[model samples]
Target: MTSDGVTTSRVVADVARELEIELPTLSSRMASSFLNQIPALQGDDAVTQLVVASTSSNLSTVIDVLQHGIPLHQISVPAAAAAHARRFAQRELPVEALLRAYRLGESQFVQWCLRLLAARSLDAAELLAAVQEITSVAARYIDQVCEHLVDIYETERRLWGQRADAARAASVRTVLGDETLDVGTAEAMIGARLRGWHVAAVAWLQSDPSDAARRVESAAQLLTEAYGRSPLTVLADDHTLWAWVSGTSRPRLDEQVLDRALVSHPDLHLALGDPGPDLAGFRSSHREALKAKAVAQMSGGTTARLTRFATVSISALLLDRLDEVRTWVGRTLGDLARDDEAMAKLRDTVRIFLQTGGSFTDAAARLHLHKNTVHYRVRKAEEIRGRPLGDGRLDVEVALVICRQLGGGVLMR
Candidate 1:
């Protein structure tokens, strides 16, 4: 080492040793004062205790750095302070609260240093140089510590957020994956009971995945308010949310209220399950809600946006066997699926015709088409299929319903 470097090290070691002698008194005084004066650091809570403990440990580390001649940046203060900062962040303490404590603690440590120098009765020249060096190093140390702590605070904050989301998703998955709940563990995780009637829902963003979770959270809160009961909500992915509202009675989720919510968030789509009671009910309801969501997405219309499981149960079950369904649609609809626009008109006419018990006038009125046009399309449709429409009315009606619900998209190979 250079001569100047050796001399500086010797000087730092001597001053550090002297400071170490005062560490006990300094730590006690600083703790008592910071706890009493800084409201942020003054509680009997676990986090507050952590703050007190970290303060004392860090003070000793500062004194050791001077005694050992270690570079301030190389010292352990930043890492130690960062660990404490993460805990504070988790406890929801404000960053300002912690920064304020550091400022106050630095003042106390400097005062203690001045008192220690005076007690030793150092020569005026030596004391002046020591005070200057100590103050300069302490300032730099605190600044570095604060910088590192802030970075760690932000990083840990994001990590904690992700961890919380993962945990919540896992808990919700567990509930839906099985027929029974762990009762205490599941309830503790979700803050809701599984022993009551539950109306489950699956919601998703139609596009723009950003802010999807915010939409899900908003929808969950809306359900909570509308039902007058708390809900268990979990974001299953960036685009999807699974939620269930609980009550002794079923939730109606009034149509007007749903319409208002949809108006507020046009990109959001919701599918609700029929209410069922208890643990089995919770699982069943969620499954149905998911199925309803699938059918709604396949159906492709604004009216399908807020579908209920009870409305689409049969179609949803059929859609579960999609390959078989495609075959059935091909055989039954035959050539009716060929002309997209014309096929849609004929299918609608047939659906309404069958729905009205085969009244051509009523079918035309419902479709806004001429009665002759309905009859002509029906005959044309029958000719294309090479079968009389009345010979297989029931089969044709079912095929038409599937065509409407699943859309031509599912029929195109």
Candidate 2:
């Protein structure tokens, strides 16, 4: 305790000085930790260096709060931290990933402090007080800084969205937002025809673009070129691109070919809508692609990088009403809704069983399980659902489809 009225122990002050001295090492280690846990946070060499700067600034801020007993309200996010947060937002990186980085960093900082304090020859009470102060300060500092960082992120994201190829984006947004607009006028604005069959698609990359416009256009072109030529492409944001490929005939899409092509462009995620005819098709098809994108985003599964509207149409339609879907899924599946590998395997078997008109032989062939094994899984699934699979079979089928497509998005949290 300090009679100087700073409300901080001299021991804490000394620790803070030690932290400042070790700032370079601590910052480097935590930066590595953040990237290791969430590889999406990594960037080019330039960005990796900036991450260390931000980490050092954030860690230094926490030390200041501990040493000075700074009030929560007076604390401000560091300039380096704020700048990197905005950069992350501009890149459209997952905000959840960035926020989680703060919590992980906080844990590391507390452990370091505790280890340093344990080496002191202090009495039990003093050691306890110092531990309490360090833990509380680090936690509170993270909370305060993260809240401010979110505001910075959101504001920058909104502004960044608004600033991307605005004229073309507004044109696309206008067409998508309205159904009654004249097809000719809309075509004139977008420089694309709406009189024929249309297949809409959304393409995006998680990494920062060296040449934003051209790279975004190339992404859209890659997804749309198979169906039609001179597709209309619009920049959605720094990280996303939207397109519509049109032709007189509805084009056939071979999923295998698409998958093979995407193997080369690892960063690109493509979502496609079904073929639709006319101006209404132009609008509706885009909505379907957006829906597929929604499910893909929720899943965040790399295997789903190439989502087709037809494959996930059911879950896409229900994405907007997911809160209801989650509740209904929980009710329909009962204990069967448990999110785990074993339960998932059982659910898949049951769904196949139901789909095959309760033919154990067919289900077994589809699942590569013996007929006896298929029967056992069906019985086990029924046991978990606490009822026979006879009633509400339709609802059961739909719920299984939802879980299969949505992954853990609608599973019991």
Q: Which candidate comes out best when scored by lDDT?
A: 2
Model 2 reaches what TM-score against the true structure? 0.63
Which residue pairs collide in model 2, if any? Answer: none
The total number of steric clashes, by the backbone 3 Å criterion, in model 1 comes to 0
lDDT of 1 by residue, 206-315 (tens): 66554656776677866765666767787654456778888777776766777676777778888888999877788789888877876776764553658888877878
Query: Candidate 1, clashing residue pairs?
Result: none
TM of each candidate vs. truth: 0.57, 0.63
RMSD of each: 22.5, 10.1
Poorest lDDT segment (10 consecutive residues) of candidate 2: 1-10
Candidate 1 Cα errors over 4 Å, as ranges: 1-165, 179-185, 224-230, 300-303
| Cα-based lDDT at residue 295, candidate 2 | 72
Error of 2 at 278 (Å): 2.9
Best by TM-score: 2
